[model samples]
Target: MLINKSFANQAGVSLIEILVTTLILGVGLLGVAALQISSLSSNQEGLFASQATAIAEDYASRVRSSKTSTVMPNTNISYAQFVAAYHNGNNAPLACAAAPAQLCRSDAGNAALDCTLAQLAIYDQWEVCSAAQEALPGGLVRVLNNGIRLTIVVDWDSEQGREDIGNVAVRNNNCSPLTGSNTRNCVILELVP
Candidate 1:
């Protein structure tokens, strides 16, 4: 029996076509995997930024509410004193573990032991700074008062391999960079309170 010439040629062409298709599919799948990895990295960066913003906003809100007469003394404690208490030299926050016993109370039993304005301010700073440290890797806080505006700066270490040097430089303009590393992320919030 003689095999048809057309049948032999068609069989060889089909095998070649399948091999080519598989190679293309493999390349496409690899591209998709890379895209997935990049997306996850971007999401993580966004989460860090969101956390920073929340921390700054929360502290600002605390300051705003602290302006009421109930929170501050009528004559002894000025708003300036409250603001001054938060001035950290761009360093890690003082440990809240040493916070005054009155400041840590959750029950009405401590209502008579009202925290002084200075102690309240310190407590607020500790609360915010501790949150930043816990939420972000290598996180830090700095409060700066330039006689006119108050600035709250929160910074943290950027994830490894995600450092865009140009972006880091731009983001850190108002805040100090992390020690020995240019790869840091920061958020700055300026407030009058």
Candidate 2:
């Protein structure tokens, strides 16, 4: 039986066709991998923002609770004074143990070494700042007051440069600490008492 020459030559895919097919598949896989990486980075950024929001909320609640009484018991110092104690900027945590003892009771071990209302405010700031630093990369906290309002600014390093979402600029001069670095992200929350 004689095989048709043309049919035999075209029976299977050529070597060049196989190589081209493999190259296309490899490029497609690489694109998928790039997309996966971008997705993971975005997820991480969202998580950090969520954490910052929660931290700011927690501190705001504490401040609100303190505003219940106009003046601290047994002291002329007012609620505004208490709020002012939290206006710290990247300062080292206050030494709670070194602070003067007062009526404000703490935990079991340090029940005797109680804190004053002002001391309590400082301690609260320290706790919030520590939380921010631990939960984020290069984290920092700034408590700012402009007489009528209180602002909590939580800053962290994004590793990669700024990510502009929805064509909105992430780095704004109004953000204070965030304006310095393109790689830094911040959550600013304002509370009015």
> Whose TM-score is greatest here?
1
Question: What would the per-residue lDDT of candidate 1 be over residues 10-101, giving only the tens digit for each residue?
Answer: 63547778999999999999999889877767777788889989998988887776667433446676666666766654544445455455
Give the C-alpha lDDT of model 2.
Answer: 0.67
Q: CA lDDT of 144 in candidate 1?
A: 72
**lDDT for each residue of candidate 2 in 47-144, tens digit (9 for 90 to 100):** 88899899889889877766654344547775567667666534332233343334343646756344556766766666677787778776767677
Best by lDDT: 1
Give TM per candidate.
Answer: 0.75, 0.74
Q: For model 1, what is the error of residue 82's alpha carbon versus the real structure, in angstroms, after optimal superposition? A: 3.1
Poorest lDDT segment (10 consecutive residues) of candidate 2: 160-169
The list of candidate 2 runs beyond 4 A from truth reads 1-8, 69-75, 89-114, 160-179
